[model samples]
Target: MMRTTTNSEITKGIVLKAMPYKENDQLVTIYTYEFGKLTIRARGSRKLTSKNAPSLLSITQGEYEITLHNGLSTLIRGTAIDYYQNIKKTIEAEIIANYLLEYFYRYEEENKPSLEHYQFLAGILEALDIGYDYRIIYAYINCFIMKENGVELMMDGCVVCGNHHVDAFSLESGGFVCHEHMHLNDLRLPKEQLQAIRYLYKCPIERLNELHLADIGPIQKIFEYYVDEFCGVNLRSRKFVKSIL
Candidate 1:
């Protein structure tokens, strides 16, 4: 048997992050539509004259040529498709976009292709670039992440009594609770806000442009608490977004 270093392939992907490897090299993590997540090494990408540098930035979508090896793949070359310059130019959108990129980077498994995840990432980036409300996008993605992890919040009726009228979101019950069943500390959620959250979870990412919620803070907090309690992972980027809001 012989080992080969020329197992090369081409794929379309978005750069999640890039870290300096050697003095003039980089290790780039990319989530591809075809191959899921890949870490490719780019030699001399740190130099100002490097052609591969522009296509390697975070959130840049491009077509890449990679020489796959057993340990780490090497980047042969790439061409940029979308820079998402609109997202990079706006600070708030940039933060939320980074948060999204970090979220996927942390949760998405390597070499496991998920068209759903890839499409969701690509759609959200496009929506953000188009100047949709970042808060609504964040709220929507929170529900998405929670649902994908099997910790989806029960939004239809009270998790306790099945009552149509719900008041507060009870972390203990993992869903809405009527006034009779709500704990002393449960946060009271208004009917409109409750409906909004339900809509967010069910709404397609592409249709987000047609909807808007003036205040997403309350709903966002509910999903955040749900994720923290059930998922057991807290993202630091979430806190950064919270601080500025």
Candidate 2:
């Protein structure tokens, strides 16, 4: 059996990257406003004085309509609705955005589009569209990792030995520890930071802007523990981001 392709138009997405191709063309990966993720070729976009070049290269945000034909997708044209140079100017925004791209490409299952993940990225991008806030940004990402991995860490009580006066959180046990289960080497979080993390797990994304972290250091540490132990691979860019920040 033979399959044939059809041409169509798609009005969605934000350009994620513009990579060189041959002599005069470029390849673009867009986080589509409609389809989630898409790739398209922009023919002759590298030529000097080409009108589409600037727009295509600068199409960092907003929706776009692409032309498709004969199994080829091209950025025939698009208009910029909202854009900010803050992402490029601020190291925090840049790293966060790149981390997002890496996370999506690494974990997002193909042919399986999740509106939560898409919406989460969109929300974080909106937050980054403004000035950089390192702690807030990292917290936003840390909580997402938990949901993405389905690791519902018990925040209120110890997973190994339930205790009301829990002090230290144990990565191995999935939550805080009672005095009996607490190890001398286990990380202990201050009361306020522990509460901050608990609220983050329960907080809805829409209301996250109102949530405040008493301390991002411990939450970030806790998040790293989970990613290292469970997710199995640490983001290489994480180090770079920490260095620059």
Candidate 3:
């Protein structure tokens, strides 16, 4: 059989999800530095003798050779980059890592490359691999993702009145609100929690390791509310991570 080499490109990417396809193939969803998110079919990847099988695992980073044909892209070859092996050492870490992948997969658009966002995801995965506190990493990554997407919470003041003294966060209003403007359903966030969010908003992604918060529950709730109301994503992996925590 003669092989055609048209439309082939090589890129670095991380596998977000890989599922069995047909008899001896795998369908992979990858987030790449050169191209945002892509769904590529891996031919003959299910067989034990396949060389590309190991690199297709979820959260595995690698370089991929992809060929596009008939509007569908197929991964022709792959080389393992960073498996982040430490992240798979424990169930909790795995769940959190999976949640991160799911969150990005749900929100990021296909074929629109944002190098900053790509680097942010890569940095967070590296942090996870190096044994950072999962909760802190989760909160920071959520905030960074939201910020990158331009839907980050307004921490400067009340979204409605611009008041600096905020008593609660109104998910419907999309920001913090003063006591006078607070809705009945708004979540009452403590001053410390508000300050923490403010810091996260301005903090650099690489400097996230230096931050320490005694309680992350409030911040996590804020992020969840933002994701649900704005991004319209309900991540099952997020729920699973919470259950085991």
Best by lDDT: 1
Question: TM-score, each model?
Answer: 0.91, 0.82, 0.84
Lowest summed lDDT over 10 consecutive residues: which window, candidate 2?
1-10
- Candidate 1 per-residue lDDT, tens place, 1-245, comes to 11325767888999999999989999999998877888889999999999989999997999998887666889999889999999999888988988889888888887778889889999989999999988888887888778878886687889988998888887777778888988898878767787787788788987887776677788888888777877765787987888666
- Cα lDDT listed for each candidate: 0.84, 0.67, 0.81
What is the clash count for each candidate, in the order shown?
0, 2, 0
Task: Please report, as a residue range, the 10-residue window in candidate 3 with the lowest summed lDDT.
Answer: 1-10
Superposition error at 110 for model 1 (Å): 1.3
In the order shown, the candidates' Cα RMSDs to the true structure are 2.7, 3.5, 3.9
Per-residue alpha-carbon lDDT of model 3 for 160-202, expressed as tens digits? 9899989887878777899999988998877888778777777
CA error at residue 36 for candidate 2, angstroms: 2.3
Candidate 2 vs candidate 3: which has greater TM-score? 3
lDDT tens per residue, model 2, 114-185:
566667776677677765365667666866776678777887787775677877877777777877889887
Stretches > 4 Å off in candidate 3: 1-7, 144-150, 157-191
Q: Is 2 or 3 the stronger prediction by lDDT?
A: 3
Over all chains combined, what TM-score does candidate 2 have? 0.82
Candidate 2 residue spans exceeding 4 A from truth: 1-7, 54-59, 67-72, 161-165
